[model samples]
Target: MQNTVTIGKQAEQYAYQLLLQQGLQIIEQNWYCRQGEIDLIAQTNDTLIFIEVRYRTRSDYGNGAESVHYHKRRKIISCARYYIHTHPAVEKCMIRFDVFSMSRDSAGEFSSHWIQDAFQT
Candidate 1:
């Protein structure tokens, strides 16, 4: 069985491909700072997106996106602020928070849902 970290990495990779297919340019992955980690950073023509990737194998409680509660959103927002403070190049762009959620079906296939502007700073 794969560990949680391994599963998360796979989910992020899958989310990465999905974003690429949608023509979003990937700026960074697993970006880390003292605030926290942002799973993926991508750019659109006029927007800089900070993405949070979540994965779940069971829907016992809720789906992946639903798990990004208030505290998590706060952390992601704080981290995004730190990111902007450090990366001046993207400072002028519109900032958006996104969630790339993944889940495994009983057949073991993964399905993804991308929620743009999932939250805000």
Candidate 2:
């Protein structure tokens, strides 16, 4: 696998562990629809969470979380809607959008940040 893909996978695994530690139950990953892909779908305290995962090796451009552009938010929101349509019970549940970003050092150690409700629908 490409280095970036491998790093991303590791970051996702780390993010998943972080979420679980926070008492979130994961429902799905890499959820795809005509609109786009939702990196994660999870539940906590009667709330459904849609997550976006981003990893950056360096901040030369900017932090990974800042990389989520407007178009991407629209796509994620649409995908969340599609997911809700597929699961009507969840449609009525409180929804939150989160972003998890991982910044990696040369040693491959990563510092991850969780930003809840980072964007709105």
Q: Tell me the tens digit of each residue's lDDT in model 1 across 26-88.
A: 999999999899999999998999999999888898999999999999999999899989999
Q: How accurate locally, in lDDT, is each candidate?
A: 0.92, 0.89
Q: What is the TM-score of each candidate against the true structure?
A: 0.96, 0.94
What does the lDDT come to for candidate 2? 0.89
Off by over 4 Å in 1: none
Scanning candidate 2 in windows of ten residues, the lowest lDDT window is: 1-10
Let me know the TM-score candidate 1 reaches against the reference structure: 0.96
Cα error of candidate 1 at position 106, Å: 2.2
Instruction: Report how far residue 27 has shifted in candidate 1, in Å.
Output: 0.5
How many residue pairs clash in all the candidates, one count each? 0, 0
Runs of candidate 2 exceeding 4 Å displacement: none
lDDT of 2 by residue, 1-121 (tens): 3588887888888998889999999999888888889888999878999999999877888787899989989889999999999898887799999999888776767788899999998
Best-fitting candidate, measured by TM-score? 1
Question: Which residue pairs of candidate 1 clash?
Answer: none
